[model samples]
Target: MSTPSKAKRKLRDGVADIASLWNSVVENHKGENPALQQRNLGMISRVLGILPHLVALMFTAYIVWIARPGSSLFSWHPTLMCLAFMVFMLEAVLLFSPISSVLRGAGYTTKRQWHWMLQACAVAAALTGFAVITTNKYMAEKQHYTSWHGLLGLIVCCAVNLSVAGGVSVMYPAIVFNMPVMLLKRLHAIFGTVVFLGGMVTMWLGLCSTWFTNNVHHDAVLALCFACPVIVLLYVMVQVGQKIFRRRAH
Candidate 1:
């Protein structure tokens, strides 16, 4: 009945109306029209697509800065390997991503060409990094592949080279006429994913190395660096797995 009481009631009603409108929006986003939901998913995927590129670039830069490639022969190992696996190889894999590829607008043939080219760069960097570490170890009269990081890195390097060789067969299925081209592609994707994950694990192990532990004093920074590979690995796996499964289903 009073003027102030009437104003308070009006304000409460206005707040309730706003809350109801917000709830409607949230519910609509959750389960609206099928097409709208699909579009929203596409948008989310596209946004997430940029994540790997940013993470890879930042992580590689951090490692390179810490390694200071020119400081010592061993320093080049981490620097080059980080660039190889984290940057080049990641770009190569993402080139085919339907949602987030920078070349999503390009033809499949164009994407394939760039894919192999990027992969070649990755292989070159990896080999050079391997050689650097080998020479450094030799100069110091140290044993090779003594640590988990060293052994895994050796395996990843060899596997990556082999995977690239297999890609040739995928590119030219006639070379392996016995196997279906589709099958070859699937196999290549699976093998490549495994090798990529191995490389990431090796990178993580490298982080655990005495050099990294001594150099990186901040625990939070160390934790974030550790997560870099994990995020990339999950993104790649999800993308590759979805493609493989969708193909199989159809």
Candidate 2:
């Protein structure tokens, strides 16, 4: 056989071996209690749950380091926006995590309190960031919402506020007597997910901005930075989707 052919065959064999090993491991757990069967998967999920906090903190710090908040009025825009969506909003959603919430030991009421508190912080930071950017643009005599990032950001801000209002209705269903509490909760989750997705997209667009392109010179580093939020998004969606599905099943 040719050298290249041998290398290809070896790679295929390696992949097959790994797949076979994984299948065997899964088979070993067959007939076990459902929770017992999911022990390894749960461990992985717990680790994934913890990763968003670290990634958000690191990504926010990187943006702040580049933007250098307090250097000027414009500086605070990126810093505050990143903190609002990446840290506060992310944590607000994760507070309800069944397996890995930092407050998993706490009662549902406690989790609900913290969730809204973090969301309020996110809203405040987001609105303040928006105001800072508007003022910065006004002082510079620049056009507003010209770029995709700015336009989408405006929509995200509006949607976030609306979602928060929905959350209030969910929290106090008596406020909206027409809708059932269960229906209100479902609507809030759906709307909140959309807003969160918009915020992530806005962040991704910000990474593609001239400022980020110029500041982050290394291509590999920029790609890794882009992957961070995407990873968080996937984990969050999976967690949220499972809950929604389970609730529907019940």
Candidate 3:
């Protein structure tokens, strides 16, 4: 085996970069958000940066806990949607985190590309999960599109697909249409927000669906799993809206 120097360097670089980013956000927001500034910068940075992943983890853990041994292969539907698609999509949305000079230096366009990449992965995951559920339903002799979850999933998938198309199309307003780029971007942002909110609602519905309620006996854990992400995502969605329209409004 070769020396671990390369891996070490990458890891060291990553931590250092994150530290620099954290400090930048702290220093930039120090005067703006006094509550965060007064607290330990390290703690603030970690929470803001790491909270999304932790939320994803807890969401998946609850599903795994519910779907442990002997659960239907059908469980993969909620499992994949929650852990892979919805959570990943939320992270992509949050990538538009608070605007700051630190973020500007971090490459605004690069971050947007990352957002696109994450959403693309999420779409693929959703398609896979859709196939799993559809096949499972067929095997189980269940009727096609019988439940609220099924209906909602279909609607959400269409909305997400359309939003994604709009998102991409808006990037080239001149090529796509004669419309102004700003107008196209504003429209894309609206659809994107709608799709995100819909994703959150659909996931919550899936969690509270008969599958989870019947399987997971733990009451508090279930409640916590549902509440935390709902609250967090809603808050993030609001922040995103303000960031988007606030600029447009001005």
Candidate 4:
């Protein structure tokens, strides 16, 4: 029998440790498929981990197409637009790789979460900006449309933007690495505030227009804008509340 190299041995041991932890903490989430069980990360977990980005990419493409020059979208500077797109592409590469999987096994520190949040922000901003551009184009095309396609597109775009913002708040809270705990916590707190404020402003605009002008589509758009802020606020509040309660009990 051939002996395995030292590096191979270390790699095997590391993977085994991760597999053991998965079976322990994750419990029933670990699937029964033998093939998956044998893998470093289970098939389902890997897919679920990557699922968010896959959805992000699809939305990214849709928003880009709608916002691109051929459509009624905003006129963007060529250099800045290319830079933004490149940034998103870079984010995708980082998020979907084996490196991310390795990081998960290593456990996420507050610093890591902060870094992750920053990367996610770049992705979200680029995407949300695209959505806003697309909407602006639709508005420019005409005040009204005879067919429902335009209206439907607007609704979908708004929904996607809100979803992007909300999901970003969720995942971003845990992406930074290698930072001082105190600093990380402060940044986390600050980011939550920023996201909440931005979401609220977006929602307010939609609501005011809908309420005063009787804008039906604006009402739908506003729902997404409003929901993103509310959901993230509730999530952070609950997390903070739990921590406080635990501290009091301790």
lDDT of 2 by residue, 1-250 (tens): 9999998899899999999999998788786887875796788877876788888888999999999989999899999999898888888898888765789899989999999999999999999999999999999999999999999999999999999999999888899978888889888988898899999999999899888899998977899889988977876787788888998999
Global Cα lDDT for candidate 2:
0.90
lDDT of 1 by residue, 4-116 (tens): 99988998999999999999978778858889888988888877989899999999999988888788889999999998999899999999887769898999999999999
Error of 4 at 143 (Å): 14
Worst 10-residue lDDT window for candidate 1 reads: 25-34
Which residue ranges in model 1 land beyond 4 Å of their true spot?
1-43
Q: Which candidate order results from sorting by TM-score in descending order?
A: 1, 2, 3, 4
| Candidate 2: clashing residue pairs, number | 0
Model 2: pairs clashing at backbone N, Cα or C within 3 Å: none
lDDT of 2 at 164: 94
Could you tell me which 10 consecutive residues in candidate 3 have the lowest summed lDDT?
Answer: 98-107
**What are the models' TM-scores?**
0.84, 0.84, 0.75, 0.33
Local distance difference test values of all predictions, in order: 0.93, 0.90, 0.73, 0.44
How do the residues 163-215 of candidate 4 rate in per-residue lDDT, one tens digit apiece?
44444444554544555545444444444334433433343343343232342
Candidate 3, residues 197-244, lDDT tens digits: the string is 777777777777776788777877778878865765765667667877
> How many residue pairs clash per model?
0, 0, 0, 12
